[model samples]
Target: MECPVCGEHLGDAGQVLEGLDRRYAPCHACSQARLDPRAPPPEAGQPCACGRRPLDQVMAAVHAVLADGGGLAPGAPLAAVGTPLLHPFPPLRSPPFLPPSSLILLTRYATPSLARRLLAEVPEVRGVVADRGIVPGVGGATHDLLAGCDVYAEARFTPAGPLVLYKQVSTCHIEAPRPRDPKVEATDRAVRRVLPDVFVDACAGVGTLGLAAALRLVPAVVLNDAWGPAAWFAGLNLHANREALLAGEVDLLASYADLRDVPAPAAPEPVAAARADQEILVYRGSLWDLPPLLPVAGLRLAALDPFEKDPDRLRRIARRWQDRAGGEVFIP
Candidate 1:
């Protein structure tokens, strides 16, 4: 696919997938591992530069790249460089997983474009996302995407079909795939215990959680996000992963206006997109406002991964959803 903004068919998905699918062994076994990618060191088979490579070697390579651009201090420690994030693909272990591979380096030293070019010195590196940090206007548990794109596919491993998800990088929140990604595992357990007819990812971020439900072949799913980019990306992901979802014609029924464009909605803003039956209704607004917009359901389970971290607030969010929707609520 091409860049929606620049029409640049940038970032090699083939290469990205090869490296991304190279899941590392869990932490204990990762200490002395090596990940290999399909692409060569720079362009096309390379011994990936992550997973058990000598720290000095990794750091030295990164240092040289920054030095080429003339930014590395004489002897700056690693922390001064940046953080490395591995592919957000399924089966990918959770945070604190060591020696990341098929990764994107989040930095502050250069523009996203520059960082992308410089970080090419490392074979396993896919892109460079700048650390936008927690400031107003940002959303979710991630930082920001600077350069390149992010892509992932699940090969019919879970209750869902094989699927594909990609992002312009910056438009979606930062999330890595784990053996038990939020809402994914919860959805799995819920399915095993007793399958439900409908599932809702109230705070769907790019449709991960809700889509997990869709993968389980849930008869219907409602994915809503208060953020426009997220809501938009969620729709894109649903389409991209449709084959896995057994989804049909995606229809845009309604859309979101500017937040201040009108009076507070007593219901959801609008239906961004819908595919009835095995429907993935992408809505852009608060879940409280989303209830009246949801399609009918017999059995329902709603999963949420909220941005805010307050414990009390979380309890209220769950309680409120259960009261309003009268379904099983899960936060994972």
Candidate 2:
């Protein structure tokens, strides 16, 4: 089998590590990403031995494979509803890439319009374990288009010389997987939309909510995620939309390892933009570390979305926000 990371062709065999999940294989480059035989196709950060994990390279292959309809002939009939497709897990801790089994592609209505609409409006795509979503474009695993009937589309992209996108179609309403939890995203978005003056989206994920709210409500916006990968993504996305962000058409963008370490921007409007727009404050720290809202008089909302649910933490957050007027707290 060929090495997934270096793309170096290997003999028919490679030693399987005994202790790790059999579903995962350690690449020659020494990454422990999953490798599934029963899975549909390759995804981002899946230990591509090719040693080429750039976002553009990954998405290029994805677009190509998707353009080709995941090896299915153009005239091939779409998968009927109820057809199973690969469900994906969000790659949060690992490199950002699509997973082969992250989604089950299906085309029930035969038309692409309905599918496009659903993809566009669904608040948070459910069941998707993957951390990120598709880049804004017409022809990706995710897309936006509306027509008379709804259609369901599922796809996965993997590396094979190029990012190869695979897709399946189904008519039946197989519940779409929530790739990123909606409640988490909603908490972030609510802040951005409601508070338009100036905002900072600390711990921003893919930055959808922050970016969107900045585009619509705030004059300036700054986004940061505690994770290095997510911060990198915000940079990439901001670069992709730099024209707007720089022109003051969008908003400010910033990310750092620690909030205290972040260099104060030259302009206070941008910083204020980041601060005022959030309805929630998500952190991976203890409740005691929760910053006092008293410092910011206008700050109205704060939240702490942890991987593990803790009632005491929620109560603490509530008490902190309660001291200030208009401040609301949520733990979901």
Candidate 3:
């Protein structure tokens, strides 16, 4: 197999190590770099020259295992098999490189050995396991697999422009095994219709909605999330898009504030625009503490997406934003 990181032939450069739930193959260069007494430790999560990570290589091995197991069959329709509601990560979405019709196996608790053996013997299958369950807004062991390398980046194309998001796998859930979901498309359209000068994503999981708004050139966007991982990735994503942001492609002032603590009427740090129109800020604290931190008077739009069955919380948030800025609020 080819090393996803360096594109070196793994069969010739190194050995493939099968772990408890994943497999890894480090090319000789990387392996030696790790063992070399005089060299610095290889950076975690850094992509190789081929723009692939160790995780990507592991997934490739998993794909091979599935193909060898008779899990991949010709003419079979694409299907998702595993816990209902659990989806594969974004990178695996509509993997055009795979067969036209493919199968995805989503498991919450499958041993690595079993996963490999089953996928190799089973026909037409590629799978990923999130042992802690893929529940959004919940953080726990589900992300342990990504300990050393928790960030995942995916590029998405939108009508406004192309966007890249960096997400921490531990906090937010991966939605839709496919590249695009009708609901997300609908939400994007709705947001575009009332694109506000000052947009707030109250529950900005990886800042997807806010990022879309930013791409549309929303003058000011404030992304808030109570989860640390989500907030951390939101900041990283903002930085990843800094070039475009600074270029004024979409006149935007993006800010990420973690609403995990602090009291009500909290003050969010103001970010000075580099140009007359572009600025960025990142904060960490609680939702109730955001009133003082936001431009309540100028706020024009807000999106409140809470967990299913939490309509009351969503309504409360809507009411707050409505009372503060009278901005249009969207709920789902």
- Each prediction's whole-model lDDT (CA): 0.58, 0.32, 0.46
- Per-structure clash totals for the candidates: 6, 64, 20
lDDT of candidate 3 over 204-319, digit per residue (tens): 76667766666676677777766655655565566556555642332223322322222222444322222336444444445556556665455477777766557787687789
Q: Which stretches of candidate 3 lie over 4 Å from their true place?
A: 1-95, 98-130, 134-136, 139-141, 146-150, 177-192, 247-276, 296-299, 309-313
Better of 1 and 2 by TM-score: 1
Q: How many backbone clashes does candidate 1 have?
A: 6
TM-score of each: 0.69, 0.32, 0.56
What 10-residue stretch in candidate 1 is worst by lDDT? 37-46
Maximum-lDDT candidate: 1
lDDT of 1: 0.58
- Distance (Å) between predicted and true CA of 202, model 1? 0.3
lDDT over C-alpha atoms for residue 138 of model 2: 13
